[model samples]
Target: MTDATANTAPAGAGQGSLLIKDSRTAKRNGAEGRFKMYGLIAVCIGIAMLILLLTSILTSGLSAFWQTTIQIEVTLPEEKLDKSGVRDPEVMAKVTTFGYAPLLRDGLEATIAANGIETELSAKDAAELISDESVAQLRNRVLRNPDLIGQTVSVEVMASGRIDGFYKGRVTYASAERDTNISPAQLQLAEALEDKGLLNTSFNWLFLTAPDASDTRPEAAGLGVAILGSLYMMLIVLVLALPIGVAASVYLEEFAPQNRWTDLVEVNISNLAAVPSIVFGILGLAIFINFAGLPQSAPIVGGLVLTLMTLPTIIIATRAALKSVPPSIRDAALGLGASRMQSVFHHVLPLAMPGILTGTILGLAQALGETAPLLLIGMVAFVREYPEAPWEGGLFDPATALPVQVFNWTQRSDPAFVERASGAIIVLLVFLLLMNLTAIFLRRRFERRW
Candidate 1:
């Protein structure tokens, strides 16, 4: 009767009721809520940073897709361009770009006169607004169509980099006064030209199609060689790494004896995955260039180096993919009178194809952006000429990659090159995004459920 009375007293008499709030529970809930808030804050910070970075890249880089150009009608005197009445190709070639320079200057002066624009700038200064690269363009145009030598044809040419920067808001009149390469009068003349509808910014396809230009001629620089070199290297990587990495993974996972040798190989592959890419560059330099006699700065050498660096990743991803296949699938195939090789190839491989493709593409994308190994192989050299078609053995030719091009441009003293470097970064980022999107699409499209 005494124990029953004690137990039947108010529920909170001896200890706190389980349904009621306790100090420890309240503290624990507060901590959990604080943790959630912290996590939310961290996520927001990361998202904001990403938005800021992308905004910066887009703001600086998008302008590179357009170029400043001036259109003028140049009276190409037959005597100066084509001395021979017959307009012989050899004779036309004898006239240097220097000889064509005065013609362009005269054309500019004539344009100013015709447009009724007033400027106190001298004739030479007026011509200075035109890109020095234009002289070569004019000469090439005449050479291509010798008949146009005698006619007053409308020739459109790039404006000087300074004038271009003016349109892009990179240059100001006050700043031009302090600049040695360009003058206030030149900017005034450029402004006048624009007012007269003779100078304007247009889409710059050459930025993608033309080759790299010299530091002095940043107005004419482009990414043609870098693009081709990168494409070639990626092709090589996809071709070589896919088959070799897959075959090796299959043998290790499905056929090879589970022994020390295989274990050692697996360990080595994992270690290589973590090795610095520059180490592979060093290895490539010694073996490919020094011992194997492959040419320096050749895309072939870069491709081979990238292939080596990419293989370990491909192998690891492929092995994971193979292991993900259900063991029952193998049993089902074996029950249908299939050999070990037949089961893997006909049954397991099909289900794993999506993962294999995703891994291979991601590996290629990584190799595409890698600059260290390519730089070590001498691919950072200035390459002005585009590589030939693949069937012509162009893989062995000297070339630069997109990343190396960005590195090269950033090293220049010109502010224009900095803009170019940013633009190149944008291009590289676009390619990477596309590749990643493709990986995601493939994974979703071909993914199978048990």
Candidate 2:
């Protein structure tokens, strides 16, 4: 029996082999480990780049949120503002911005004199410390509050762009010495006024709340109009893009026949997604503005153009999301005595809703940051006035979008617009972040495991 067992066990049965790995297997494992290390390094580099971008944006843009203001006491001589002595607003409305300019200049001079902030600047040069828009601002204030016309009112007005840049560290003393816009003595006066509690750097809520000022009044410039314009365009895009995109996606994914025509349509849709945004801009300019006669620079036109641009993206995302749903869900719904339409709508559509909404919002966010198309549609035009209420004439009113506004500001000669553009970018990023976060939340909220 022992001889039979030895023969059956075959040759070398008593010899044992070591459990060491094969050389090829070891090399493969080492290669895998190195690949993982490379991947980790790549991820770390991406994270570092993201951090650097955010840090640069925040540091450069945060200064726009704080503005240097010169607090002045203006004695509104009755002879100048309230000659009628009736304290009537209608009478005050007749006083043009020119009529109000001397008062602001006198106020700045008096403030400097009262604070003993002596400088080499003359009375005119001292007044130049304040924004040119201050005249209009003061006139509007008096028109709004006629009783203030006869009173010595203390007002905090925005400093000129150059003066504000002095406090923001953008304009150094040496730079001011060479700049034709402002003198170094003005900076000295500003410093003294700051010490006297008259000049200050405060949180500028006006950056969010006020409208854009003239090219020369960058300190008083704000994103309010641009924000509203973007909001309006988003509303229009959301309303138009979601329904149309989803409908097209649904038909193409589930209902449409598989044929050459359908294949051609699908290929076109895919190509549209990759098309340059500037091409969409040109299309919008030609089709919407020229042919359709829609008002240029209006949110309605911008929204329509964006809707066209965003449709391909939304359709692609929605179709991919629909395809992700298991065929078993549809079969089960149909087997349970449901029609094809009911099966798709009740079971498949609900499951795909999260992805649909996510994709739509992401598309909208993309549209919100678009500038080229808007520029072609004339949204790059300067817009200082706020649009009417949405239901009234807001959609048709000429407006400037946030990205276009940033572009416009960057093109200006004023250094302060640099800060404004950066600040606008921060605002745009916040919006994009919020939209992306919402997309994430929606995806997680309704995602199904089956």
Candidate 3:
């Protein structure tokens, strides 16, 4: 019986050994490993998608930053221009773009003839090599310097959009065959002109500094107005939203009593953060536009709408930042004879400030890219004229935002407009990048370890 008991005890001890792996434990470990791998794959996928998006944006938009321009020595015949012996501004203004077209065509012809660029294109088709805005551009130049109208002056004029696209690889020789806008002969002529230094590509500063152009003048299009409008809206939002958001958050988190009313307000604020941005657009349209009678397409209205959308986000972030502060901080301040208000303001608010600023800037970045709210407020209109200076009714003037401009450009039939749209996106992304960097810098600068 002792031998039999000894054998059973040895078998029981072997069965209870910790070295043996349990089936369930092995399965759980395998599952955890697979989950980690999945998370890693997700992160890699996200990074790949970001890289692809950036690559596409840069590829499609980089061409918009440079332009093809032709150098021509134009002999503005005295007979055609300033026909009235009096070099009067009003008389010059009466000479329409048509009156200037012949001089531009003649200049291009002379440049081609002198540079030995032989082409089958007639004087009419040669005129096609220049942008539709070239006449107006020349007119404006002459208007700015009236004495130069009759003088032989060297001027740089923008090449046609198709010619610009050709150099940028958007228009190929074969594609130009079917395109009525440009022919292969024209492309060859352009190449010859390039070789002789009559035509060249250079950085297009006008695109960044000038205003939007009409559909017929894509080469002259620019983002300056849109950028200015967005800047104005952001200024309005920063002025109105930051102070109001911080004050509301401070009151609710630190001072407000925990009651049903407060609870309801908190719940509503949370809900608002999740609401669709377009709903705020509708609310703005109804209240600000319809009720208050504010000007449609004004930056002020857009700012107010975005301020509402940003408020809840700011509140949520500020509260979370406040809540992250340790209770010990409050107690220590109180123990030091600080009042409740003083304790919160002097101790808690400072600690939470980094998060508040980060969140507020992030919220503003989000607002900067928003199109829906601005769309409903009539900011989608074709705004050719720039907004007046701030003192001269700029806020109330008709102006378009960057996102709305992008939307408008995409709707156009011209492929050059698409490039313009992409370029605008690059600019918008740059602004967002700067804002986010500022947030990160501020966070690190003010972050507290305790």
Top lDDT hit? 1
Model 3: colliding residue pairs:
none
What TM-score quantifies how close candidate 3 is to the native fold? 0.91
What are the runs in model 3 whose C-alpha is more than 4 Å off? 1-25, 77-91
Model 2, stretches more than 4 Å misplaced?
A: 1-19
Clash counts for all predictions: 0, 0, 0
Q: TM-score ranking from best to worst?
A: 1, 2, 3
* Model 1 alpha-carbon miss at residue 240, Å: 0.8
Point out where model 1 deviates above 4 Å.
Answer: 1-19, 22-28
Q: Report lDDT (Cα) of residue 286, candidate 1.
A: 100
Q: What TM-score would every model get versus the actual structure?
A: 0.94, 0.93, 0.91
lDDT of each: 0.90, 0.89, 0.89
Residues 1-450 of candidate 2 have per-residue lDDT tens digits of 333343456566423433554454467678989999999999999999999998998888999999888899998887888788898888877778888888988888888888777787888988888888777888888888877867899998988999888888899999988999988888888888889988888999999978888887898899999999999999999999999999999999989999999999999999999999999999999999999999999999999999999999999999989999999999999899999889889989999999899999999999999999899899998888899889998999988889998999999988889899999999999999999999999999998888
Better of 1 and 3 by lDDT: 1
Who is ahead in TM-score, 1 or 3?
A: 1
Cα RMSD (angstroms) for every candidate in the order listed: 4.7, 4.9, 5.1
